[model samples]
Target: MAVYTEPTDEELATLLNAWGLDGLRNFKGIAEGIQNSNFLIEVRQGRFILTIYEKSVVLDDLPFYLGLTETAANAGLPAARPIRTQDGEMVQMIRGKPTSLCTFLDGVSSQHPPSSQTRAAGAALAQLHLALADYPQKRPNDLGPHNWSELWAGRAAHSEDLEPGIAPSIDQDLKEFAANWPRDLPRGIIHADLFPDNVLFLGDRVNGLIDFYFACEDFLAYDLAVMLNAWCFEANGREFDLVKGRALIMGYETVRPLSQSERNALPLLARGAALRFFLTRLVDWVTPMDGALVRKKDPRDYAARLAFHRNARSAADYGAPE
Candidate 1:
């Protein structure tokens, strides 16, 4: 449960009315995202996801993300398009924070090994890369791992009120890695967070991708690396279906093939991706934010995942797809 913002049902309905999107028959908070207070709102036989942006959201960059989704939607990709108010503004100030409504995306989130849904999720992610390839909009890539680590690491190290288990050394390690990780590779719009929770599936197919707040401009390979961290691994700290990796890469390659150089960079890229999540999780552990209703993700969990990458010889080292 992410609590980036909290609004009562009455407050939400009032906000909807203020924006001319009223007539809400029902609504409830969505329990998945950790960055915003989200809800699935119902009205006129349709559903929508409403978010009240929190202090964490960069107000000026809101247009870049919201605009990306709108452009990606035009490109035939599955992502939420921010609906405009009657006045035609994409984002409106609500309750002193940025708030907006999106057409409720269809499908459920994949939690573990992807069950029967990995291939389609893989294919759709590729499609997303293809769709956003030509959109002319550009913004700084602000949500990569290094920034995530820096966001919490500073507060964690300075906090003396947190639990003893929260180690501050992760901040140093993450900073070192960020300073030295490889750059100079293929760059494009990366969906910086494509975890199972962020990807939605219908039946055996991927129907939508959510959580664009972390989206940015980075190496396309880095996007694939994020998928390998979230989709291709197991919960008990082991590698399972490696084809999830193949399906994802193959699907993306169908639209844009990886150069030999890109392929060679993936292992190191995956290590960088792994360390990114580990560092963020560790920072949150040391300095949990006050009034945050969301459950803090375990940084140690990713630290353990990093160990698996340490042993990875190649994507093939995990076993090929059937």
Candidate 2:
């Protein structure tokens, strides 16, 4: 979360008044993520996070995101629960932007997670999928395979500029994913962006999962694919660490075993996951927002990952059991 819109003390006070929270001790902008403006808010009762939604998040989709986290939290998942206003509204508006207050979860994000931590993350993610198995609400994966072409449109040169011959490789990967994307895998709510920054860890345990803005109904294995790219890869974003990948998949399977079909489709799913992030990052690099307090991630990181996944023939390539 980044500070794109700066709200004053009086404005914050008025907003907190609606929630019956008084005496704002302190508030500070969080500069970790790229999508929303987040602030750590302290009041008489306790600490909370005030998130101001920025661009790319549809205002209409707020309820689904909030409900997903609420459901997950209620089901005993370590997820941040939404705080409702006195009027029972989970979403509010501040400075003409959609906003909400979420209970602060205690833990720190690990930038370079060890194998043990990855194992816990994998188990936690599987537990999250199980918790949302019967979630009544459903939201489409807006950034799924079908939307990649549009996101990649007009960005070929940008890819080539970053590295020669990368554009054609990306184009070929997109076509292959479109033609071979899985159809009948287990489907449910997925935390599409389950990167380390989005998960809080207290030692070896996963304290909480945050930033459900990208959560949507999609292939369950696809979430694992996202994690493979997110947690199993080294910090340099070049090589995929087999040891870490094995620990993560084993931990996940302990909670929810993968079917043979899911295992067979994992390599393709991993490629798709890498492509999704690469395309989005490329777009952001090409057409960046001016004066926005957001960091444009290096798309080349995902590009290197995509190149690696291209040669992967099975889940074993990611250190999963054959």
The candidate maximizing lDDT is 2
- How far residue 119's Cα lies from its native spot in candidate 2, in Å, is 0.5
Which regions of candidate 2 are displaced past 4 Å? none
TM-score of each: 0.82, 0.94
Please give the RMSD of candidate 2 to the true structure: 1.8
lDDT for each residue of candidate 2 in 1-322, tens digit (9 for 90 to 100): 4477888878888889988898789899988556688899999989999989887688899999999999999999899899999999998898789998989999999988999999999999999999999999889998999999999888888789997899888788887887888899999999999999988999998998998888999999999999999999986579999999999999999999999999999999999999999998888888857756556789989989998999999999999986
Q: Can you give the lDDT of residue 226 in candidate 2?
A: 97
The C-alpha RMSD in Å for every predicted model, in order, reads 4.3, 1.8
Clashing pairs in 2: 1-33
Q: Global lDDT for candidate 2?
A: 0.90
Clashes of each: 1, 1
By summed lDDT, the worst window of 10 consecutive residues in model 2 runs over: 287-296
Best by TM-score: 2
